[model samples]
Target chain A: GAGVSQSPSNKVTEKGKDVELRCDPISGHTALYWYRQSLGQGLEFLIYFQGNSAPDKSGLPSDRFSAERTGGSVSTLTIQRTQQEDSAVYLCASSPTSGTEAFFGQGTRLTVV
Target chain B: AQRVTQPEKLLSVFKGAPVELKCNYSYSGSPELFWYVQYSRQRLQLLLRHISRESIKGFTADLNKGETSFHLKKPFAQEEDSAMYYCALGGGRGSRLTFGEGTQLTVNP
Candidate 1:
């Protein structure tokens, strides 16, 4: 893809239900990132991936929020047991390498009811 | 820990007015600072980086190590510049960015 792509531009789920958001990063990019954007909160770092391995997961809000990338390309963010506070835009970005400019996806708006 | 702070959540300015968006960060090592902007209904894009020292669309930001601030400034604001601006800090190689809360800039004609 010419840019980072996120699936299901919008997702609404009931409390306690699990949801999975997917991301397809730009081809050949070695670095991928996940962020959560809430109203007034800005972008919160969630995870960072380098070649399919996550070197940083400290930003994950809780254990229920987990993510993984495979083939050094597509990635998935799974939220177990959604909460109302979890409602936010989940953004995905990819860079040619670490510490470089990142290209972002349109973002998946997750609304937990 | 690395963190970025943007004090203003909203800013308004008349066209051709000077504008400044303040940003401050706390990082142990020399950090990479960047300004990202998002126009209405558009994706977030890079406006400039402190490392480049180049101006983009008339906007520039300088990283002040003594003050730990990277403030974005422009001599003349334009309507097209109205958007949400974010300040981000990176810990260097293999590190993720820490973003500020962002400021919504509105330029009234």
Candidate 2:
């Protein structure tokens, strides 16, 4: 893809439901990242994937938040038993490699009612 | 841990006026700082990075390790500069970037 692509641009779910956000990174990109943006707030780091190495999960807020990347191209962010506080836009980004300027996705706005 | 801090949540400036958006960081090692922006109904985009040491859209940022700051400055503010700005830090062998709370800059005419 020419740019990072995220699925289901908007999502609304009941509290405690599980939601999955998907990201398709640019071709040949080696780094993928997921972030959360609350209402009128900054991007919150969630997880990072570089190649086949272990992912950096340091930023995941809780055990309910998890992510996985397959074949180093597509990634998914899963938030289980979502809470009201989880209502936010989930953004995904990809860089040609680590330490480079990243390109971002349109983001999936999740609304936990 | 590496973190980015943007002091102001809202900044208002007049057209052609000089403007500055403050940012600070905390890290154990050398920090790679970046400024990202978001226009209305647009996705977040990178503005500039400390390592590049380049200016974009008349905005420049100098990384000062002595004070742990990377402030974005512009000599003449434009109406199009009215947007949300975020300061971010990227380093420590991770692909992720840590971002600040963001500052909404409004360049008034």
Candidate 3:
């Protein structure tokens, strides 16, 4: 079976620019999540989506970060006015449901210069 | 707030030697504990969960409520086991995971 997939394996952008990272979850997966991994740091949860419910944005670092999952499938993480501190690996994951083990994507390495 | 803690930033052991990766967590309620592993060039994946009570790749972890820990252990380490290991905690119905800083395990053969 196909696993979760993310686009733009690596991205380099100047500070103050905006970038969008895509994620395609495995078929039939109803839950999606986004996280960020900084050097030598743990995975920082960003947002979560389950079915048609409102997404959980508690972990989002700031108002500039947002995400959307359409048709209960594809998801996109957008960072507005990127900062050098935002440089990190953006990871996406999906699960059969809220409590199941999650399957992750290769991640998009975002670099802000 | 829920949190997962991996005290050691790195662990090294020779092949066939015993291995233990300590993980402690703090949460207000009952939490689900998990161990996730990421091999070089590979995506992060689940190694084991405390609920399953099963070992994967010769690794096992026990959930201790008294100590609030879920430590991964292997009787015999393998060179292939060299990778980054993260301990995670899931609480609430949404099942969002809080991860630890991670431990880089280097198994020497």
Candidate 4:
């Protein structure tokens, strides 16, 4: 892809339901990241993936939030038992490598009702 | 831990006026800094990076190690410059970016 791409631009779900957000990073990019943005808030770091090494999951807010990147190209973020607090925009970004400027996706607006 | 802080939540400026959006960071080591912008109905995009030392859309940011700041500035503001701006920091072994609370810049004609 020319830039970072995300799927299902908008999602509405009931509390306790599970939701999945997908990201397709630019070709040959080795670093991918996921972030959350709440209304009137900053971007919250979630997780990061670089190559096949262990992902840095320190930013995940809770056990219900998890993410996985397959073959270092496509990634998926899964939220289990979503809560009202989960209603926000989920953004994904990719950089050619670490310590470089990253390109972002349009983001998926997840609404937990 | 690395952190980014944008002090102002909202900034209003008139067209042709000088504008400055303050940003500060706290990091133990040398870090990469960047400014990202989000316009109405548009995706977030990178406006400038410290390492690049380049200006985009008439915006420039200088990373000051002594002050631990990366403030975005422009000599003259324009109506199109109205948007949400974020300051981000990246360092350590991970590729994740730590962002500051964004500032919404509104330029009036």
Highest TM-score among the candidates is held by which one?
4
What TM-score does prediction 3 earn?
Answer: 0.90
Docking class of 2: medium
DockQ comparison, 2 vs 4, better candidate: 4
Cα lDDT tens digits for candidate 2, A1-113: 67899998999999999999999999998999999989877778888888888998988999999999998899999999999999999999998877567889999999999
Model 4 lDDT tens row, A19-48: 999999999989999999898777888998
- TM-score of chain A, predicted model 4, versus the true chain A, to 2 decimals: 0.98
DockQ order, best first, reads: 1, 4, 3, 2
lDDT (Cα atoms) of all candidates against the true structure: 0.91, 0.90, 0.91, 0.92
Clash totals, every prediction: 0, 0, 0, 0
- Residue B41's lDDT within candidate 4 is 82
TM-score of chain B of 1: 0.98
Q: Give the alpha carbon lDDT tens digit for every residue of A1-113 in model 1.
A: 67999998999999999999999999999989999998766788899998745458888999999998888889999999999999999999988878678889999999998
User: By DockQ, is 3 or 4 better?
Assistant: 4
Put down candidate 3 lDDT per residue, A11-109, tens digits, no spaces: 999999999999999999888999998886668889999888899899899999999999999999999999999999999999887746788999999
Against the native complex, each candidate's DockQ, computed on alpha carbons, is 0.64, 0.54, 0.58, 0.60
Ranked candidates, highest lDDT first: 4, 3, 1, 2
What's the iRMSD of model 4?
A: 2.1
Candidate 4 lDDT at B28 equals 90
Q: Show model 3 residue runs off by greater than 4 Å.
A: none
Here, model 3's chain A TM-score works out at 0.98
